[model samples]
Target: MEWFKVVAFVVCVLPTAHCASDAIVWCYHLPSCNDKTWPTISPQYCNGSRQSPINIVSASATPNNNLTKFTFVKYDDTSAMTSIENTGDTVKVTFKSGVKISGGDLSEQYDSLQFHLHWGNGSSVPGSEHTVDGKRYPMELHIVNSKSSYNGNTSLAVKDSTGLAALGFFIEVREAAHEMI
Candidate 1:
C-alpha cells in the first residue's frame, strides 16, 4: 500500500511539474506580477530607475517652453498593415513606414513601427500600463516608433537611449460600442 502511494505521488507530480513552472516563466501573468519573482524571470522588466506604468499627476506636471509643438507628417495616408497578431498578452499591428513624426523636443525624427493594445479581463479591472493619479484604465493603446537615424532597423535602434519611443493613450469604457468599431 505504501509503495502504491509513493508511485501515485511521483506520477502526479513529475509529469505535471514542467507544465506548472513553464506557465509562470512564459506568461508572467497576474499571479506572478509581484516584485519579488518578476525580477528573477526578466531583469530588464524591472531594471533602470524609470519604470513603465508610471503614475502621472497632471497637477504637478511642469511645462517646458523650450520644447516646441510636434508636427505629424503624412500620418493620414492610407497604408496596408504588414502584420497583425495576438501575442497572448496583447494584440499588435505592424505597418510599413507609413507615417513619421518630427519637431518637439526630439533630437531626431521617428517613424511608425507598430501599435499594440493592452486590456484587462473586465471593466472592474484596470489595464493601462500608465496610471493617472494611481488610476488604471480598462484599456490602453501603444504606438511604437524608432528614430529615423536607425534607418528602419528597430533592433539596432532599441539599444540606444533615443532609439525607441512609445505613445500611450487610454480607452474609456462606453455604455455602448462606438461607431468606429
Candidate 2:
C-alpha cells in the first residue's frame, strides 16, 4: 500500500518519469513503516511466524545428500531480447521465453518469469534482502519463477504453497564489472 504512494510521489515530483534511487530509499526507510516497523504495515511482516529475508544460521542448517544438483534448461540458448525497463523501484529485464529450472529440492520444474536487481549506492553498507549469519550483501539478484503446476497462471499460482520460487544470488563488488552488465 505504501509503495504505491512512493510510486505516485516519483511520478509527480520528478520532472522526468524516471525515479532516482534516493527517492526509493525514503520509501523503504519510512520512519513509520520500515523493517523495524513492519508490524505497522501488516501483521504478516513481523507478527507472523512465516517471514522472508531471514538470517541463515549455518550451524543449525542440516544438509540432505538426497537433494539433487540444480539444472537449467535452455539457459544458454540465444534468444531475442524482449524488453528492459526501469520501473522506478527496480530495473527489470523481461524475456520472450523463459528458462526451466529443475532439480535441487524441486519436484516440479519451474520457469523463470523475470529477473530483478536490488542494490545500494555503492556504499559499504549492504542493500540485499537476505543475510547470512546476520551479514548483508551490497547487492542481490532474484530470478523469480513459477512452478509448472500452475499451467502458466501466475496469479493463481501465487496463492498456493510451493507454487513459486526465487533463486537469489549475492552480488559482490569487484574491480571489473561483468561483460553482461
Candidate 3:
C-alpha cells in the first residue's frame, strides 16, 4: 500500500494553553510521564480547566458571523522565521519579530512566536495528531502566538488563559508512482 497525504487548512480558534515548561520531567511516550502518570507527574495540568482530548459537540455550536479575515503583519517579507531548532520532540521554528495576526474573531492581535511540526512514523491506524473521520495525517504544524499586549514577556503571557494561540495546520505526504509499460 502507498502513503496517502493529508492537506487541510483547518483553523480552529479556542481558548488554549500557554507555552510554559518547568524542571518537571514529562513526555508523550516516556513511561514515567505518560498519560497514566500525568496526574501524579504534573498535577497542575491535570486540574479542572486544563483537561485535554475533549469531545466537540458540533450539534451545539453556534456560528459566529463576526469572524473577519486575519490580518498578517510583516509576513510578506519572507524573513519571518528567525531560527530553527530540534527540541527532541519536533522541529521548531522561531518566527521573526513583528510578524503578527489580528482579526478573525481574535480578541487582540497576536504576535507570532514559534511553530513546530509533530509527526509519527508511517503507521497504519495512527499517523498524525490532527485527524478527521478517524484518519490521521502524516504531519501537523503548530504556529504558536502570544497576545501582542504581552510584549514578548512569556512569563506574563502564560498567566492568562487566553494569552496564547496555536494555529494548527495538517500536512499529508503522498506517494507518487511511475511505471514502465
- Give all TM-scores, in the order shown: 0.71, 0.72, 0.74
Query: lDDT: which is higher, 1 or 2?
Result: 1
Q: Which stretches of candidate 1 lie over 4 Å from their true place?
A: 1-29, 34-37, 123-125, 175-181
lDDT of 3 by residue, 1-181 (tens): 3554546544444333421346665455455555456666666655444433233344665678988887888878787889999886789999888999888778899998998887777753234455555555677777778889999996776667777767776677765675547
Q: Of 2 and 3, which scores higher on lDDT?
A: 3
Model 3 clashing residue pairs (backbone): 6-172, 80-96
Tens digits of lDDT, candidate 2, 1-181: 1110110000001111111232233234445644555544554324543445457666987776867877887778677236788978678976455677778676688877777876776553347666667766667777777787786787665565566777777666544333443
Each model's Cα RMSD = 16.0, 11.7, 4.2
Q: lDDT score of model 3? A: 0.67
lDDT-sorted candidate list, best first = 3, 1, 2
| CA-lDDT, candidates in order | 0.59, 0.58, 0.67
Q: Considering only N, C-alpha and C atoms within 3 Å, which residue pairs clash in candidate 1? A: 53-129
- Evaluate residue 144 in candidate 2 and report its C-alpha lDDT on the 0 to 100 scale: 71
Off by over 4 Å in 3: 1-20, 30-37, 50-62, 124-127, 130-134, 175-181
Local error of candidate 1 at residue 44 (angstroms): 4.7
